[model samples]
Target: MQGLTPTESISFILVFLEGILSFFSPCVIPLIPIYISYLAGNAKQVAEDGTITFHRKKVFFHTLFFVLGISFAFFILGMSFTALGTFFQSNQLLFTRIGGILILILGLYQVGLLDIKFLQRERKFQIPLGDREANPLLAFAMGFTFSFAWTPCVGPALSSVLILASGTGSSLTGNLLVLVYSLGFVIPFLLLGLFTTQVLNFLNVHKKFLKYTVKAGGILLILIGIMTFTGWMNGVTKYLSKFTPPALTREEENLPPEESDTASESDSAENSEAKEEPVKTPAFDFTLTDQFGNEHTLSDYKGKVVFLNFWATWCPPCQMEMPDIEEIYQEFDKNEGDIVILGISNPSSAEYPDNADKSKEEVLAYLEDNKYTFPIVFDETGEVLQDYFISAFPTSFFIDKEGNFFGYATGLMTKSQIYQALEQALAATEQPSE
Candidate 1:
């Protein structure tokens, strides 16, 4: 439910750039002429004084429909990937690890270090252009069918993107990512349709550059794979977030006295007229003891803004953000104030061996050694983690004072972001009944 953060924005930009690079793939750029010829088969062309001119009006609209068809196919692909992601959302950590490994192998294939035969083989539907004129309908059908025409050439890049899309937090995010990539791949096609002669001349001249596109994309995928596998992307995201200006401030807390009085009067009237209903508590509630042996239930903290952070002892990003959590905990009077900060960890045990590297004893010892005073709790059975759909380490959830799910953020967060999220949670109002 959160707005696009700096990390998401950066990811979208990279996906868009990847799409643009896909257009210049070996199978794509070289075959542009053939595709254009099919699209503008009957359009007039004039050759005058060593220069070429295409019938722009005739070809442009056809190209538009062709790209639209490609876009439609891409959208469908995005939806399918997103749906798959949603189904596997609970096993997010497993999905990320598997996806990272797959991406790494694909990167190797792209760099020529590995030989993946299926990837090297191209399989696409072929449409014969014997005598049919290039009308908008035909162009659209061609664009849709031919989208799979260069699968082998674009597969590596496209697969990497689909893997990313499948791991996103929301279906909408995954779909938007694919849309951005489609824009990158199709914008060039649209331009070529408009200025076919000029683009063909440029491509013919600088054809040497096309060979490097795969290599560049391969290196990028490799880096992303390593970061994702090691859980370092969250740290990078946290670092980048430092450059984003704070979205909200505490100035609103210092309203004028007259305005406060008026608000208080309005609240009094509303409270008198409004009937009180039992506050709905969410289902992820649990009774767990902290390191100090004091048990806590999520429902018990209904009147307070709860900052529940799901982390692991082995996660570097989790360790990196501990100090900030400690600082914030102290600022909030160590949970004595209206805000309560709790760290949830699922250490490795016979029951949940995949959850963490350390045992519960080791986790407690680590907390003691680090002198982290914030309340640290254990999800011994790991049910809490499943209920929360925790795919990545250092994921934080914010609950409003009314115990409603305000929103959540994945990856590490800075102190400022943590504060902003808490503020937003505190300011959030309850959803009305249907």
Candidate 2:
């Protein structure tokens, strides 16, 4: 609930400038004229002579609704970030570390150090020109939907802003931050729509140099990510702390017990009523086809320690964990046959609904492009996915040398965590069985 500090006021100006730079990014700038034309319903306005013949009123109103639509979308995103931060307030430091690493990767991708092709894939939401022109409502809806298609530059900048907004400890503050960002973003578009011909001329004249805009944005994004990772904001935060007023002192007293806590203890006793029962399970086995057409059966790898990972190329956590998985798997030679790693990617097991419909060819290409040396499988029918009951991507299960179900983890795991799991699985191989 604190107001903006001097440093924050300065940061907001930078955020706004970054928004302008995002407007000039390669993905968005070239398409600006088309968007203007679509909204104005005046394709001939920016013709060879740069006539600027569009109806001013129509352009202004259309662009206004468009701006409102995207701004609303951004506000909702801000609320979501605030809610997420609230839920993880107890673990904010850990949450920040994870966010920092992700932002760093995105920065690297933006700078061309990493070529994550999927990140560059824009959502192809092409509304028919006639449809938009015929109905202004459709034009407004187009603007609303287009907000979801955030380009690479805007994505990282917005992410950084959301991090700051979330730390404000108030949902209203978070929403305002996004509104400010959208305001900073929407102003340029409004201007460009008003003066389409001149803007196009300016853009065309400076087309060659505009390429550096994205690079510069990428560099700035990288710095923000580094600052976040190293907690460089602390010094600035310390300065801002001086402005905060002291709270009136209150008398201390013993607090009453929470009902939910008492109820939960009673509930725990009731829940344990079924705990006396034990169920026997049979050994799990399944086969899947590798990318090269060879079949790998779990039964075939019996008596060897196995690291079974379920992952998808589109999953960021899956991608982040791959390097460590590769390193650990490489430690044991395949020729030795004592330790093995099997990566299973099922089309039907895609964790993200947006990435669910990926083609077999795409999956294969991604695997090959990444140059992963471990055995990979494409579960075309998802039969393996069914047998394992997997609903989350980047899930890992370790099987002991005796092929018993040793341990399993849901969601992402760090390199050290995976190694610890490995050590536990290795230890499982030595202990006497009951």
Candidate 3:
């Protein structure tokens, strides 16, 4: 939570809400009584005069174990999705398109707009517990087993959320999103543990409402798919960011300039001196000016690895990762020539007709307001943007010491990821020209 942005917080909340909705799916809700009965075991007591009671302590413990099992399955699923997201981070635009379309289709299926045979098929493990007392272990196993049972009903909503998880910038955030979702889904179960009899009765009486849950979930998924596919989620986040607290500075946390300089010197000294044959493949070189009126040409920095970040002021992901970039820039001693971090932008003009249209003055003021010192060069003619084939807002290219195009990663990257990328670029041999 140290650097949780307003946009991230909002996204987490939305995911959590989706989890809550999943719990109310038609498959899960109508059958709650049977599940609770199995979990409750011998805890239930009945007396004359139609009175009923449950051993709250025993029931709560059993339910706790059961929910934990569900959480375990959910966590594993989240990790898988997060890993997929990381793998596809370099082609985020394509991933977004595919994920969005898949979610939208699932939404339609859920809403009865389309009938998908496999989605309707139930695949649950048969665990017979007839005339047997349910212990904590049994409850836990059953909970875990039943999670698969509920999948057919919850798949649409859960899959949609997982797709979003796959698009997150880091595994930590992605896992946390799943955790929040699990909490939303399981909180009701925990509440049922505490008040088993009342909850069962209430659900039974209001069973009619359960049928609507799928439609509502479908609508929600549709909205999410549209937002993600069109990249409008960032715009919404940008708007809400105005209401959040101002950005916090991490100056005290960063390494001092002297120490950073010494580290850079050590890194350079330790790097391999035996040179391999240089490849003729060269990066597209261009001349541009930074916000501070400093002119930088790509070919001038031949012996240093360059982290070239293409970004725009209007891009939320770009803005989200700037602080991390700033930290790297400072830790590498600002522009010491061993490793250079630079940002590339294009102001709105006929040459570059796109959503990012902030003039040079606006870009400067924005940078000044945020106190970002990393050098950003303006591609006035938009030639460099085209040369790079930038299909997304926050694409980055790594250039090796020989001025060869090393590699590129699309979307947001954490500070550690940036460091790893720089190291790879520094260690890489010159590539053959295409």
Candidate 4:
């Protein structure tokens, strides 16, 4: 899989760090010591003589269970924020701005620039019904309750996850994405809990780092907020979409039967009159490489009917028409006519203007994945397409035997339409030989 961009990687790291810091906010941090003390209540005092200082594995498991509960609670909160953003389409921008501002405020709070009284309000939301006595399970319940009640404290981290989820285009994927994000936060909390005393001691000695860390986080939130407000982030995403290839247009589709028949009659009458005159045509030839790296020349297949299909990997209609082309190829393969189907994949690359660096291997993979077995040629330089002045995808040209251009189609074609064109080419080529 392709790795994420530098910006995406940095953003994810910031979000993960924000989660850990939120867990250590003043409202939540002091309570961790209280909860640990409660869980170790009489056990620690009885073992003060060092006779039974170590807790059993059961105690550890209970503590971990509480951690799981907190993670799940946060995950659900993230889901709710995502759902709220998705349900109302008209106020999407309004909600996005609100979320961004909320994140900015939380960041400022972390830097001690702002203090909201509501941030300190804590309620006993998670009641432990079964275990009134202190156990690891009760501690877990406390952790879960803390996650729900401390929403204002961790708003920045939660907002980041909700923003990511909203962009996923579906609520289900968004919810799961936040769950993964919660894991990013939960892992550190579990580790800190395992060695709480050591962590507190380390924090005391390196207290200066906390201020700088919070400032750095604040700056990141400010940048994200600015980008969100100005729509620069969305613009960047939109600009990237230009790399996608163009699709077929409706005007390029063939005319209906009545019009087609009239046009055909007019052309036939004109051709009958022009038969008495002589015409001169330029010699056209070129060398190109197929997807397999094999070279082919137009001159080599001189006395044959060749359907040259010019297309690109990114073109959706081009992708759709491949099967019809393949069916035509199969029919012609068994016929007496010297027919050949040649596919030219137009090149596109970031380095090459108007072309992409879509490798031959990648093109082959796409074809194989889609079950396309046509003989495809590569045109990384766009030499063939430019030479023919072809501007649309799936442009097909019928070259009769003896190298005469019979006719062409500029857009998508059905199986019947292609077969009819092939029959016309066959007739045109047979007339010269007869």
- Per-residue lDDT of model 3, residues 1-434, tens digit only: 11111112225665677688889865466446545766766676666975666678988998999999888766655454345533433344454556566556666776788777653331110112124376888777767655644543454445444533433434555577778889999999998899976754554456567447546867766776676567554344334333322221111126553554355446434432332222233576899999888999999998999989988788777899899999899999997958999999878654444424387778888999999999999988665764554445576767779786655555666676577667756765444332
Question: Which segments of model 3 are wrong by more than 4 Å?
Answer: 1-280, 350-355, 430-434
List TM-score per model, in order.
Answer: 0.43, 0.35, 0.37, 0.39
Give the Cα lDDT of each candidate.
Answer: 0.63, 0.55, 0.63, 0.53
Ranked by lDDT, the better of candidates 1 and 4 is 1
User: Which of the predicted structures, 1 or 2, would earn the higher lDDT when compared with the native?
Assistant: 1
lDDT of 1 by residue, 1-434 (tens): 12212112225665677689779764355346446656655564546764545578887988999998888766655443345534444444454565456556656766778876654431110122223367888788767655644333354455445544543434565677788889999999988788865654554455467447656756766665665566555345434333332221121235653564355446534643663432222425788889998898989998899999877777777888899999999999999888999999877787655453479999999999999989888888766765564455677777777665555555667787688668756654443442
**Native-referenced Cα lDDT, model 3:** 0.63
Candidate 1 to truth, TM: 0.43
Ranking by TM-score: 1, 4, 3, 2
Candidate closer to the true structure by lDDT (higher is better), 3 or 4: 3
Supply the TM-score for candidate 2: 0.35
Give the top-scoring candidate (TM-score). 1
